[model samples]
Target: MDSYKLLINLPDTIVFLSPNLKVVDATDEYLKATMKTREELIGQDFLTTFPDNPSELLSHNMMIVRDSLMRVIATKDTDLLATLRYDIPKPESQGGGFEERYWEAVHKPVVDENGNLKYIIQRTSDVTQNVLAKRAAELEENKYRFMMNALPQLIYTTDNTGRATFFNQKWYDYTGTNPDILATNSWQSSIHPEDLPKVIEKVGHSLRNGTEFQMELRVRNGKGIYRWFLTRSIPMRDENNNILMWVGSSVDVHNTREMVFELEQSHEQMVELSEQVQQAYGKAEAERKVLHNLIMKAPVFFCVLRGPEHRYELMNERYQKLFPNRNLIGQSVAEALPEVAEQGFVKVLDEVYETGREFVAEKIKVTLDRYGNGKLEEMTLTFMYQTIYDENSKVTGIMVCGFDVGEQISS
Candidate 1:
């Protein structure tokens, strides 16, 4: 067999260059891949024949290729270049533009008996698809991280063995701890002593059984004040339903729990004093007023929506301030806040109302025409919809309570 014919017919995209970096020859596969014929490539300078894409202002393809070739010459050994974006120009008949491409290349030097470099052999493979796929995956991961960090709740991830692996910024901010704490039991030390045992037992059981873990525990904040947090963790599974990891969130519910306790106490006192109609009625009314005042003065926004259409029955001062120009009371949510409905809040409301289940969402994005000028503005909220019941235990309305966390997240 002819040696030159054998080299040209080889199935790999290979090119041979002289010691002076002049193209000596290339395989047929190389000619086809580069959209050039042997007549156009042979005898031409290797760098001149395949120049960097001029349209790309920050292109470093020529520099990288030259450095790899120089390294091979210096070491007299093979040099590998991975994931290089070396675009190729199209022929004028093909509309005359550069086509974006990625490649993996190997540059090997052939030496003579005297150890002098004779020829440089280049082998390259197109890796455009793999490079693009990796970039897309990285972009998706970045988006996921952005969403996690935007949440008001503390977000974390753990291995199947219940060992913590990752925690978002909110976790560090709330705990006033650094990444070093994850390696030790320092995070657990922040949990109240009374709640630590239960948390450990529940987490261990969940890890053993691959079940969801949930608990309301008191966690000490940056100021060393213990506050109640509703913590929940769910197992992330693989295709075969095997546990891979755990994703968890801890939402601070201290104020809501305190308010509920106060309401329950007031309800019990009203029931006990019911026999004395005049005295009971006055005392119950006074208690109701005090509770109303407390709700009004709370830091979070609060509202009550009645009926299936979600007509705004009442809104606290904070809630009303969210849409100062709109008349929310006596108006359906869809009528008063069309933008909210457009963003699918009404569907979420319907689901909660129909199921009679509380829906809690943290860092939910809500767009509103705040000034009634038809200009939409986006805001982030950490909120909940709790089912309200009538005297006979029939679901009547929904109580909406939330904090506008836009400023907090931005800062």
Candidate 2:
């Protein structure tokens, strides 16, 4: 029987180790994974051939591996190491430095029928990508937590079971309660007694139906005064459209509610005054006022560019941050962002104009002068350019809407 032939055909990266921890044989996958040839590895001591990289955080990674191998040999039991950060050194021709890596490894002992240790089978899987992705997610979650805490409004998150998972610092500040108490659902104790049952019933119905949960209820503040708040929750879903958790916010609306009630009570007196004001100003002015307010206050970055040259016609407050000092209202993209023309974004605009087609781009990479310095830096943005048509149904301009999603792209 050809023992080596069987080991060589395995798809996983595997290495056969003698009792003394020498590399007796390895699979082709092992050779390709390690960028090594059979002659360089076959007779070498396993630890010496793949030593712990000096750049690694833990100096004893190799030592820990050796200990695991020894334990398997002594007990004749398989040992699994879930994950370890172990960098690998590149060959001299490849610049000779260690590259960061992660591995899921196992040491399986091969015992003879007489219960004597014959060899150790070491198998390893590269899991660097998974580790990095998990780390990035953690960092992003932490960033969001910080942002939530900074806001004045109370914010909270709950798991699928409707149990509290997280509450921002603002929640504690407003409720005068700590996480330990909130963890036990004590935050609900701050709700107005008369409104509690109604709020809970509404929330229960939303949770059961997987719909948006919203309620206007009076909440007791830190000073023990009940004030009106509009608490709302939305489901956060995964890529598969399955609800993962609930993110909710509690916004104080006590003053606004009081003002609205006062206005309603004085409607008879305001009716005459409102009619006089309407007579003074045409109906078109009122409509324009409403439209202007919507554009100025909308959360998204909104803009419009007219003509084939793509001269900017309008930009909202949020869009103005793209280039703080430079006014883009009448400048073409090429004139306002000369650095972008070289990055091929100007060509993208031209294509959209020529075809009169809406262009949607996500994570589009461009080099721009982020700090007003002549030196350009790369940035990623997700944006859309929709053609605006004239009365004759001809393309006249492009409407733009987008925001900076660089953090998401990098993650």
Cα TM-score per model: 0.72, 0.58
* Per-residue lDDT of candidate 1, residues 337-378 (tens digit): 888889898998998788565678878788889988999998
lDDT of 1 at 344: 91
Best by TM-score: 1
Count the clashes in each prediction: 0, 0
Regions of model 2 farther than 4 Å from truth:
1-3, 72-78, 111-116, 159-164, 180-183, 204-215, 235-245, 255-411
Model 2 per-residue lDDT tens digits across residues 216-322: 89988789989998787888889998889998887776754674465444553444455656567865565455455556555556789899998999888878876
Candidate with top lDDT is 1
**Runs in model 1 lying further than 4 Å from the true structure:** 71-77, 80-83, 274-383, 387-398, 401-411
Cα RMSD for predicted model 1? 7.1
Could you tell me the lDDT of residue 124 within candidate 2?
A: 97
